[model samples]
Target: MKILFATSEAHPLIKTGGLADVSGSLPSALAHYKHKVRLVLPAYRAVMERLPEKSLKQVAKLSVGGCGREFEAVIWQLKAGAVPGVDVPVWLVDIPALFDRPGNPYLAEDGADWWDNGERFGVFSKVVAELAMDRAGLQWQPDVVHVNDWQTGLVSALLSVETQRPKTVFTVHNMAYPGNFPHSLFAQLQLPESLWNLDGVEFWGHFSMLKAGLICSDWVTTVSPTYAKEICYPEYAYGFEGVLQKRAAEGRLIGILNGIDEHIWNPEVDELIHSRYSAEKGRVAGKQRNKAFLIEELALLNGLSETRIQGHLADWLQAPLIGFVGRLVEQKGIDLVLEVLPELIEQTPANFVFVGSGHKSFENALRDLAQRYPERMWVYIGYSETLAHQVEAGADMFLMPSRFEPCGLNQMYSLAYGTPPIVHHTGGLADTVVNATDENMLAGTATGFVFYDPSRFALKSTLLHALGLFAKKRSWQKLQKTGMQQAFGWKASAQRYLALYVED
Candidate 1:
């Protein structure tokens, strides 16, 4: 099958979140299965810097319309070596004026979203839709045009007019970040006035790109089955539950879990960590060495491994190390973590390491906590690729108490690295992590800790429960081994997508 993978972000070039990881890895997974794929996204300045000048060859020059203005798009081409035995073609829509100077693809240096984002990604979707229609001077047309998230949601909307067009699969990575614009944008964006009705792009009074895609696409899917079900409820839908329910009634809505690229995330061969180990051998020692290394690197007191607070260490490491790696935002339950910080430090005997940056209030709170307990807590404000891999490889327990997640990659990555994730019971977190309840443990199906209720007290108690279990070395190791053995690779997801791509 020939697939046109369209999105605003992709890994190894540009990534703001998990959507990029999916866009980057899934096509490679498909190519590995012998399906040809062409990945297309805007050529932001960061992408240009990452690619060799010689590798980016100009393919076509065309005029794209958006924001009542015409922008000249210079499409650059590259043969990406993303999968073995496959040199996937990448179409980079280059409009330097829009994509050249950026702190983030969607935000300014001050962290406010770029005022022209609507116009920016608007042009991106137009180009992708044209390519799907074989009107962009590209001879190759896709059998399936798979668009991701709200950034490219307009691609499906733009393609709705074509009678001889390829089928489209629009995926909602996170329904939370809907691309909504003022009703005035309809005229400014030069969109047809007919799109303002209830069944069209207009939602209430705003132009909703995600709604447009959901309505226009041949099929719609979210990241996980639970998330697919969750979005049908008003609390989780963010005002689109009715439309989603209608799609479900028509049997056009589906769910497929996202997968991690094991080639990069594998602990056994990853060069980003201090020590390499597989589940079969050296996992215990590897974790020990990594915990020690992390302690030293964070400038935390290196005596946690020696300061016998409890009788459970047995001459080995003392307190267990817990980790948090994600954006420091309210949606991530950072507010909940803030409420439990003191309890976690003073009450529980676990050391903490945090690696991410977001929401200045959360950042300030975390900084204060680190200062208050320099030895027991560490905070790295910015994210580092190497450090993220190291944290997953090193941390004894990974904490992801999100209020809701579509399909989080960190929990999957944690499982791969033998770090048991204590997550909120919602979305993909519930689907992946088999809670360490007595029933599951006896059945030999327990993997990680799970807590209900998006509250501080709930997260606090769950952490305490996990810490209690940490004393039992045999049980903890069994839990880690079970998590490590669980697979979240792309083969199954790719197969599901292929099935969708080939379906009548």
Candidate 2:
């Protein structure tokens, strides 16, 4: 199968969120299974800096029309090693005028969305459609054109007009960002007139790129099975319930769980952590050393192993070190953590470390809390690749109390690193983490802790339950090993996608 994977972002090139992680790993997984994959994305300034011009071979030069203007763009493909894990061909659509700036790809420096984002992604989607239709003079066509998120949603819309086009698969990473613009801009971008109706791209007097993909594509999929079902209702659909409900009724909607790249996330081989360990060997001692290292690094006082030796030390060193890593937004249930932390810190022996940046109020509140209890709490307001890996490797338990998640990769990463995550039972969190109830624990099937309900009370009580289980060393180790043994790799998910491509 020749799969053209189109996304607005891909890891190691450009990233704003989990969409990049999926775009980066899934294609490499497919290629590993003997499928031909050509990963395509816009050539942002950051992307250009990573791939030297000398290494990129210009494949074609063509005129792309969008945004009520005609522009000249070149298509470039690397000779080899386009992605790190697998050698898949990378095709970059280079239009310097639109994508040559720095900072966030879709936002200006002021943190506001770029005024021209509609035009920026609009033009990129046009180029992708051309490639999919074999009109770019590349002499290569895809059997399946898989587009991700609203950024490239227009590709499915643009391809809807062609009779002899490849099958289109549109994936919704998150329903919150719909890529909506004023209806006036729809005419300015020169989209097909046929797409102006409600059944197409039009939505409540706006041009919805997401709706375009949902209605135009041959199939639609979300990140997890629960999320796939959630979007058919008003709560998660974000005003697309009618459209998605129709797709679901027709059996064209699905939920496929996302996978983490084991090559980068596996604790035994990761280079970013302080020490390496696996479930079968040295995990207890390894986690102790890494936790002590993290305690010293973050300037947190307690929980450090005093002996600094290879084997386990006194029982005091086994105190819980909790970790949280993600955007500090209300949707992530950061407020719940904030509400519960003051009491949790005063009452329990656990120490917490947070590494992420988002929402000024949340950041300021976290900083103040950290200052109040410098030893018990530490907050780093920005993201660090090394620190992210360290937290997963070192923390006794990870916290991810998201209000809702389409499909989360961090929980999977935590499981792989032997850190049992305590997550809210919703979306992918529910699909992945098996609650450590008595039944599951007795059967040796429990991996992590799960809490239902969307309140601080639920999260705090769940944390307490997890802490109780953490006190029992043998039971905790069994839970960790169970999570470590689970398979959350991309190969199986990629195979599921391949099955979709070959259907009918």
lDDT of 2 by residue, 185-235 (tens): 789888789989978999999999999899999999999999999889899
Off by over 4 Å in 1: 82-87, 300-316
TM-score of each: 0.95, 0.96
Q: List ranges where model 2 is wrong by over 4 Å.
A: 300-316
Top candidate when judged by lDDT against the true structure: 2
Q: Residue-wise lDDT of candidate 1 within 1-504, one digit each (tens)?
A: 889999888887788889988988998899998887999999988888878688778888788887777899988888776323224789999988788886878999988999988888888888898888888787888999999988898888778877889999999999998899887776787776666689889888888888988888999999999999999999899999999999999999998999999888988988889999989989999988887666666643323343332333332247888999999998899899889888878987788889999989999999898888866787888988878988898789999999999989999999999999999999999899999998988887899999999988889889998999999999999999999999899999999999988887
Worst 10 residues of 1 by lDDT: 307-316
Per-model CA lDDT versus the true structure: 0.86, 0.90
Candidate 1 Cα deviation (angstroms), residue 327: 0.9
> Candidate 2's C-alpha lDDT?
0.90
